[model samples]
Target: MRLPSTAHTSRPWRIHGIAPDFRVEDVWALPTPGGPDDLPHLVGQFTEGEEPGMAGSSFAYRTLFAVRRRLGRLLHLDDADGGVGGRVASLRDRLPADLLAAPRGPDSDALPFRSVYLLHDEWAAELANRTVHAVLHLGWVPDGAGGYRGQMAVLVKPNGLLGAAYLLGIKPFRYVVVYPGLLRSIGRRWQETAGRRK
Candidate 1:
């Protein structure tokens, strides 16, 4: 479910340190509730595209990704020349010594994102393009019952007026279509996978 910005900012997340300049675009409570050690398993599933909501399965979810890609191509939004190291700097460059030494699991092939860092309870990935530079963060939060649950937040540094406008335009679609499908799919996948592990 969508949450208030404070839900993300109130947490003492390391992401805040590196992305102070960016805005917390969105925060969500994922359905994948589990124990502490379950985070890596969740992250692994995400990286492998095992989550059904991400790629396809649902018409709405698939269509959203398709439209975004087409728009990106048409507008040259995700062009390499206008992406990280060109239009904007990479967030990885700002990592502290300890974070720099931390594990960077893997780069995302489907999403134009690069691994930033991976911690025991959190993982972050970054993407930069013409419209905005963004970070996708996944965190493990204790559930107060000797377990944990997944939390996700999106951080974005819009490039200029265009970036801001683009985000504004997509906000409704994200809320009504994109996010709902994503959460539902992830939840179903989590149940399927978790069942197997048990």
Candidate 2:
């Protein structure tokens, strides 16, 4: 479900230290609820965008994906030269020595993003194009009942007027059409994953 920006801002996430300038664009409480060990599965499912019960299942969600891709192509937004270490400097370059030395997670095959780093409770990946430099952050947070659930937050540094305009244009669609379906998919997958833990 869509959460208030405070849901991300209030957390003492390591992301805060790296991308302090990026705005917390969206935060959602994911459906996966398990212990700390379950995080790797969540990350695995997310990175594998073709997971049977995940996002890109519904027509609306797929349509949004198509539109986003088409828009990217038309605007030359996601070109090779527009990626990390190209148009914008990578956040990895800004990582603290410890983080730089830590094992970065597997690179995403579904998205044009590179894995930044992964820790026991958190995983972060980054993508940069013409419109913005974005970070997808996943955290395993306490559910207050002796279990952990996944939390996803998007942070972005919009490039310019075009970037700001693009974000504003997609706000309604993202909230109305995309996120609900995504959350439902995550919930279903989480249930399946949690059941298997028994």
Tell me the TM-score of each prediction against the true structure: 0.93, 0.92
Top TM-score hit:
1
Please provide, for model 2 over 1-198, each residue's C-alpha lDDT reduced to its tens digit, 9 standing for 90 to 100: 677899888888888999999999999989787886777888877777573233437887787788888988998999988889889888888899999899898776776768898988889999998888999898888988898888999999998998899889989997887778778887777776666665
In model 1, how large is the Cα lDDT of residue 156? Answer: 94
Per candidate, the number of residue pairs that clash is: 0, 0
Off by over 4 Å in 2: 49-56, 195-198
Q: Which residue runs does candidate 1 get wrong by more than 4 Å?
A: 50-52, 195-198
Top candidate when judged by lDDT against the true structure: 1
Residue 186 shift from truth in candidate 2, angstroms: 1.6
Alpha-carbon RMSD, candidate 2: 2.0
All models: lDDT? 0.84, 0.83
Q: List pairs with backbone clashes in candidate 2.
A: none
